[model samples]
Target: MTLGIDVVRAAPKVLLHDHLDGGLRPQTIAELAAGIGHELPVADPAGLGGWFAEAADSGSLERYLETFEHTVAVMQSAEALTRVARECVEDLAADGVVYAEIRYAPEQHVSAGLTLDEVVAAVQQGFDEASASGGIVVRQLLTAMRHQARSREIAELAVAWRDRGVAGFDIAGAEAGNPPTRHLDAFEYLQRENAHFTIHAGEAFGLPSIWQALQWCGADRLGHGVRIVDDITVHPDGTAELGRLAAYVRDKRIPLEMCPASNVQTGAADSIAEHPIGLLTRLGFRVTVNTDNRLMSNTSMSKEMHALCEAFDYGLADLRWFTINAMKSAFLPFDQRLALINDVIKPGYDKF
Candidate 1:
């Protein structure tokens, strides 16, 4: 027998690909907006969040990115950054997320005359405080905007803060026209320094975008690689065919940070029922469930797992596979990872 949605909600989870800016409390956004005298799309929390989700539905990646203006606007100060980061961890902890890696662009917070280091320090401080209070382990991923030409500086910032709370580097924003390869210099520097980086590819775009990120830029993971399914085919006889890129990705065991609800909202998949998570899981691909943006998608790790369970009939064992896969793909030290597996993950699964 296997536990269902009620049990899954209590199960501990590991989260990757969650953005700090994208996960702010709707109430916090409104409060911050008021403090800064910035006008929001909606005055109320529920309506404000709906506006973000609606604006992000634009098929074009550039258009989808326009919604970030509101999030980034309120995050211009260190105090705001710290408060939001702390609350984000608290919220996840209450929702049963044990470990999480949150990413944000440092450059986006400098409008308040704060240096990049100040921004990183503020968010790290927030994570530290939240961890103390909530007992949740949180790490940071510093991101560089692909359209911006300052990736090298952002990479350096990530490396500088790695000893603190920063865990890795990532490229975000408008992944269609601006591929990860455009930031080759930053990727080369990170590679030379042995830093881990994941790229946003194959989400709103297709396979060519994924190929460029992995083949040219050497990404450690694929952020929203949902569109990599394009490289796969199935014959009338029920035999699956894998194209070269798909085969390479599968063989390499590169993690796919799949955000099911976000994928549907962005048209990456037709619906959660038809999502390739079920297909890829059966094929042994390293698939991890994530809530790309809790506010924008109105989701959490629990909701994502519940959705998968209902959509694919996943049970306790299947949920265990997702958790272990996420732990394996997490950018944590070997000892800590094993400890989490043995101490936290296994015990939670047993209870379910």
Candidate 2:
């Protein structure tokens, strides 16, 4: 039987595409804004959370991104970064996320007196302190703004800190005109160094964007690869046809970091009921659920799973499948991934 939302909430989860600045607690944001003498559209924490969700609900992708300006405004200092990072782990632990890879661009945080290295150090310290509570493994993905010209620097930063706590590199920001091919040099550098990287593609764009990321830049995973559904056509007789690109993605077993709610808000999908994650997951295309922006979407891992359960009739067993898929696709070493599966994820789900 499909259990209730309570069981879904209690299930151990893995998060792969959450953003650090976008996941801050509303109260933390308010406090940080005040401490920095910055202004917010809403001052009260509860009101501010609602405001973020409402603002992000705008149907335009460009308009949806504007909500980040406030969150990024308060995160320019080391103290603010550490506090947000620590609270991020604590909140994820409370929400039953046993493992997560939180990504943030270091370039966005250097406007204050801190250097790029100082920013990473502060966030790492926060994750370390929060992990002391146990039952949570948090890693970092140093992201570069794709619309900017610093991807090579960010990729090098990821490689330099691979032995420390940084797990991999990623390219984020708008995807309209800034195609992944623009950063081919950075991707090629990571390839030569044998480093891992995922590119944000096929979200606001279409299949050509995804092809460039995978075929041109060699991405390990597709961030918000929701638009790949464009290549799939469902017939009236309930049969489906897969385009060459979709077939290649499935045959290659490429992971799609699908964020359902965020897709709806950003106009990638019509709604959760009609979201492509259901089709992709059922088709065995290496689907993984994620919360792209917890604060903006007002979501958690449990919330995302519960929504999918209601949307797709997913049960405990089905939820376990998604959890394990995310774990397998994680950038963590094989030993670490298997240990988490054996000791944490499987046991946690088996109990339910």
Candidate 3:
């Protein structure tokens, strides 16, 4: 039997889809904006929160992304990046996230005159400081912008910081016009270096993007792979049929970093009540729940799990599976990942 919502909220969670730039504290944004003299859509924290939610609910990824202008505007300095990263750890720890990998494109933060190496160092320092004080273990995923031609540089950057704090690499931003294959050189380089990377695919785009990411670009995982559902077919007898790509993904246990609230906001799904998370979970797709953006989507790991339970009637067993799935998909080493599952995740699930 499943415990109540409180028990669920207290369950140890693993997050893989959180963005470093997207989960900024509203107060931090206001303070950073003030320091940089950048104008904001809203000043008060309460109003700023509402502004982000409302702006992101526009149902168009392009329009929804316009909101990041204000966020990225203030994250130009080392001090600002460090503060945001530290706060991200503190907030995730409070939400019962035991392990999280936060992703951000370093090139975006360089417009304010900081070097790419400086941007990575500042965020890494903040993560180290926050983890020293907090109970959560936070890792960084250095991201390359898909629209730009800097994936190889970002991949090298992630490798350069592998010993510091960066756990892996990723390609983010508008996945429509730009495909992961555009950065094949970067993925090839990372492959040669024996590095890990996840590609943002099948969110706003369809399966071709996903196919290329996995087959051509060789992504270790898929971000917002909600569209993989397109490859599945339901028969009159209610048995599910998986297309070749879907079956390969399932057979290989490639992780799908599904962010339900963010998916709904970006029109990846119609609504929370009608998301494919339940279907994907039932089909054993190695689905893991996450908060893509805390400020923009106004979400956390606890809130995201609670919403999943409400949407799919999930219980402790289902929640535990999600936790294990995330731990399996994390870029951490195998022994450490198993230790976390045995010592932390399973014990919490048993308590519930």
Candidate 4:
């Protein structure tokens, strides 16, 4: 049975990859920008929202990333960070996201005289406040910009705050020249400390990026590993073959955090229907759906699931599988993950 959008929206979801800075409410951006005297391409909230979607749809990873200038500009202070983070939780909860890991680079928010620790504290404050009354549980994943040299510093920060609320660490940026191995020291630190991290690979780049992220950097999960499809070849008689690397990924159950809408906007895929997720899911790979950037992609977890149902003819069982896959792949403790799967996710989906 084809689930309607409303039904999909009501299904409990788990988001493994979402950008805190990229999911700001349009109205909040307008108010905050005006308060700080930051100039935006469009002053009105509606126009600004449309502008971001259009600007980020440039079909180039670098150009797509450039849309963050305005959002990041308005988020320099503690008040702004707290407010944005709180609203992010509220919004995700309303969208039926029972669990999520929101990521952002602390280095980018420190230009306002705040230290890296202070930046994390402010964002955590927001998450805590919203989670107090909660239907949702939210955690932070501190990200280090791949082009920067502060990854080791950020890794330490994540470990320092792991008990406070920070769940893990990550590195994300242009995937062309800045390979994941550049941050080998940071990943090594995380591994030694028994921390978890996901590397942004196989998105704009190809198999080499994925190979380095897993083989050299030792990432726990792959961020946007859509390009793993390149390693798989299909025959006309409907058989498929997986190359060595692809076979390894599937064999080990490495989760691919696939963002369909964002991938299409960034030219990683032509359209949602043509996305590699369909092929990957069919091949029995551990695939989880996500909204990499809500404002930039104009998407939510519900919208992403609904789109997939339309594209792949998925039903509630399929949606349940994706949510379970995400919860299993989360950086949360094994016991906690099991509880959410048995107590929350599976039961919630059974209601449908």
Candidate 5:
């Protein structure tokens, strides 16, 4: 059966890759920017929202990333950070996201004199307040800009806050010049401390980026590893072959945090119909759907699932599989993951 958008929105979902900075409400950005005297490209909330979505659809990774200047500018204060973070949880919960790992770079929020630790504390405060009401469980993933030199510091910060709402660490930015291996020291430190991290690779770049992220940095998961499809070839007779890297990824069950809308916006894939997700899912890769940037992509978990259903003719079972895959790949404890799957995700899907 074809799932309607309403049904998809009502289904419980899990998101592994969402950017906190990229998901701010346009109205909130206008308000915060006004408070801080920061001038936006568009003053009207609706216009600003449209501006972000349009500007991000530029088909260039670097150009797409340029939309963040306004969102990041307004988020420099503790009050703004807390408000955005709190609203993020509330919004996700309302959209049927039962679990999520929201990531943002702490260093980016420290420009207004807040320290990295203070920034994390502020964001966590917001998450804790919203999570206290209880429909959703949310955690933070501290990200370090791949073009910067503070990854080791961010990794340590994630470790320090591991017990308090922070789940993992990540590195993200334009992937052309900034390879994941550049932060080897940070990844090594995370490994020694038994911390988890996912690297942004294979989105703008290709197979070598994925190979280096897995083999060199020892990433726990791959962020937008869409280009891994480069290693697989389909024959005219309908047979397919996998290169060593593709075979290893599937064999190891490495989770690919696939963000369809964001991928299309960044020119990672031509369109949803042509996305690599269909082939990867058919071939048994650990594919999990996500909204890499909600404001930028103008998407939510429900919208992403609905799009996949439309494109691949997926039903509730397929949606359930994606949800289960995401939960299994989460940075949460194994026992906790099992409980959510059995008590929350499975039972939730069974009702449909």
Candidate 6:
């Protein structure tokens, strides 16, 4: 059941919770910044990448959140947005990702004079261009920052672009003070329209955050639900028992977009071996692996899968299980999900 990194990289994968702004190539960031006359703390591309990875490992919620300031600062125009979006697809496709849902906050990209719709169009243009020649299937998830009050605006955008390229909606940011309930109107509207949405909960906060996201906001999935690990109890005999919240999550089949490297970098866990995903996956909680921020975490879907396989001694079947879990939880239509799993993922992995 042991696997190598090369074999893992060659295996087909699915990613459900990657951030568009968080996955930019360092060289691309430098080029964009130079064109806009933006000053960067680290001008060299390799050094800049290392800076983000090192800076993100601060383990403090406030400090970790600050790393996005530079990345978002450079991505304020259509050219920067399109280039970042295009590179996101190319990078993931090179890492063997067959399907992915990339999320980004439109409200943050309005510094130079681009409207919310224009930002979406620019990113969509990049994805369409990538899809024309690549083998990867990429979709968009319109994200509204939880600290901001623009969820309704972003939610409506997702609904409007349902037929275009956007697949769903999400609200992400610091989860401690800004709970998902603050965006009740947006969640309510999405629910009424039967539109899909996920909430960022239980990453920096605890069970109360998760309770509000699901019980109050009606989230279809949990973004970084690592804190749900607090509800379960593990005994000396090696047996584990799920608390009420954990039981409900499992019973309802709610997908957990568990990001291993990002969680460790953000202090959600002490290490990957200590990550609750090991036990959560064993207990069957509809768990799926993710690269929360590719730049900050220095990770890819293939690397995430390889890390888990090394940590858990997983093989081809375990990798397949996680890939299928993500594919099932994709916001893409059921027929399309089925086609990718049956036609692409299965056949691709069959070679090894």
What's the C-alpha lDDT at position 4 in model 2?
76
Q: Candidate 4 at residue 32, lDDT?
A: 99
Model 1 lDDT tens row, 1-352:
3346568778889999899988998889999999999898789988888877777775665656666788889999989999999999999998888889999989999998999999999999899999996557899999999999999999998988888888899999877689888899999999999999999999988999999999999999999898888888978876788999999999999999999999988888988999989888887899999999887787899899998888888887888889888888888887988889889999988974
Best by lDDT: 4
Better of 4 and 6 by lDDT: 4
Per-prediction TM-score to the true structure, in the order listed:
0.95, 0.98, 0.97, 0.99, 0.98, 0.98
Candidate 3: C-alpha lDDT:
0.90
Of 3 and 4, the candidate ahead on TM-score is 4
* Residue 101 shift from truth in candidate 5, angstroms: 0.3
lDDT of each: 0.89, 0.91, 0.90, 0.95, 0.94, 0.90
On the 0 to 100 scale, the lDDT of residue 315 in model 5 is 96
Pairs of colliding residues, candidate 4: none
Please, what are the lDDT tens digits per residue for candidate 3 over residues 177-253? Answer: 99898999999999999999999999989999999999999999999899999999989997999999999999999
The digit string of per-residue lDDT tens for model 5 on 146-208 reads: 999999999999999999999999999878888889999999999999999999999989998
Ranking of predictions according to lDDT: 4, 5, 2, 6, 3, 1
How many clashes in each candidate? 0, 0, 0, 0, 0, 0
RMSD, each candidate, Å?
1.8, 1.1, 1.3, 0.9, 0.9, 1.1
Task: Give RMSD (Å) of candidate 3 vs. truth.
Answer: 1.3
RMSD of 2: 1.1
User: In candidate 6, what residue range of length 10 has the lowest lDDT sum?
Assistant: 58-67
